[model samples]
Target: MLSPKLEVVITPNRIAVRNVGSGATATADAPFSCSHLLADDIDILEHAAQGAMKQVVGGGFLPSYPIVEVSTGGRPLHQVERKVIRDALANAGASKVHFAPSVTDVDEQADARAAYIAAAKRRR
Candidate 1:
């Protein structure tokens, strides 16, 4: 989980996240999903949160490993969601990125995300 210093907000159509101390920010917008399973706002928010975390982690800092892996609810992201995530990453200066094809355990994923956020903040 993110530390108390991190903040995440979700709305009907968008989500925003940031590290409170470092001023590093990330955001993702809701895009239409083809499958009902991925239609919830929470799903979109999850996608956005992943994007935000990638930004905080400076995915664009090094071109050698430009493809950051995003999570997609343990399955492949829908075509639309994939495009949205890819576009967001590109806008953040991550020239090339892809989503993880498999899911990480829940607690483990949370811990990993927190670590990434913390590490990114430290760099600032």
Candidate 2:
């Protein structure tokens, strides 16, 4: 079976996660400002990722490797910032990761995902 796709949106104060296939969604609030690139405390970002993953998974089973797409509220990320986000997702059991440009509407996320998948297929 194919692994599920997970989408995560990170902002300064919150992290929202959605399992695309299952439609299970969860959100985690940061104790302080926790933007992926600007935060002084990376641990808090990691913790928020963990907390959101736990909430989405709940008592249900989660695949060992899920395709994850993370959006940093439309801001571009530096190499270090990307690494920080990747590490957090890795801790949440993500194997494949994609970075999305900031999206405003919830519907835009689905469109972005479709475009990404199409581009990835062309690359292969």
Candidate 3:
């Protein structure tokens, strides 16, 4: 085996689930997921998510985030949800992950603003 250009966006965990009939059930959990990008790929994760959604969902696509917030790690989604997620990721640009709370701050805000401006200007 060899290391590739893939990125690991998730770590495995053990969690408990409640069944309608059974009281509780413990099972292995994976709260995070990653996209494998081809070599020298930028925004590989987004592309991976896009492709995954299309492959996973077929046509329909939804998202885990609310109508406003941009995120893939939210409540569970059905198969159709994946396509929505795919389009969302594809439509999302640098602004998507950069807007994260962990990355949000005065400096980050300035940077984001600058980026948005540049993108907007470029579009015109």
Candidate 4:
């Protein structure tokens, strides 16, 4: 049996936030499924996680790569996977920049949301 590791993942959406009332540093994590899953180190599946000191406004677990099945038989899917991946990203409050069909280049996409927030904090 050949189990083709099917999955979708990106960079963790880390946005440190301070508790509204307690002023506590809380790190909000996305769902475990959203994290990277790799059958092989050399060839790893896409995944993402976010770290924060406080609860983020609206960022939360948005299911991506809904399922990873082991496929022994193989035909192929050319572009549809991209659409599913795009939808996942959108659900997570991320921009669909890398979800394009033509971008065949297999690179990871991550929003440095934490850095942006940090920068804004500095400016303030």
Among all candidates shown, the one with the greatest lDDT = 2
1 or 3: which has the higher lDDT? Answer: 1
lDDT of the structure predicted as candidate 2: 0.71
**Clash pairs (backbone) in predicted model 2:** 74-102
lDDT of 4 by residue, 1-124 (tens): 1211122223233222333333344333343222332111111112321233102222354222122211111212224344443443334333332432323432332247567788999998
Candidate 3 has its poorest 10 consecutive residues by lDDT at 1-10
For residues 68-124, could you state the per-residue lDDT of candidate 2 as single tens digits? 888867755556667777776786667787887563233436688899999999999
lDDT (Cα, 0-100) at 87 in candidate 1: 66
List model 1 lDDT by residue over 1-124, tens digit each. Answer: 2222334443334555555456777776776244443334434544565566556545534232233445553443445545655565445434445545463223436688899999999999
Ranking by TM-score: 2, 1, 4, 3
lDDT of candidate 3 over 4-120, digit per residue (tens): 111112112211212212222222233223332111222443454344323322334433221122222223333333343334343522112212233221242567879999999
Please report the TM-score between candidate 2 and the true structure: 0.66
Better of 1 and 4 by lDDT: 1
Tell me which of candidates 2 and 4 scores higher on TM-score.
2
Candidate 2, residue 73: lDDT? 72
Pairs of colliding residues, candidate 4: 9-46, 9-47, 12-49, 25-53, 26-53, 26-54, 27-52
Q: Record all residue pairs in model 1 with backbone atoms less than 3 Å apart, i.e. clashing.
A: none
> Which of 1 and 2 is ahead in TM-score?
2
TM-score of every candidate? 0.35, 0.66, 0.22, 0.23
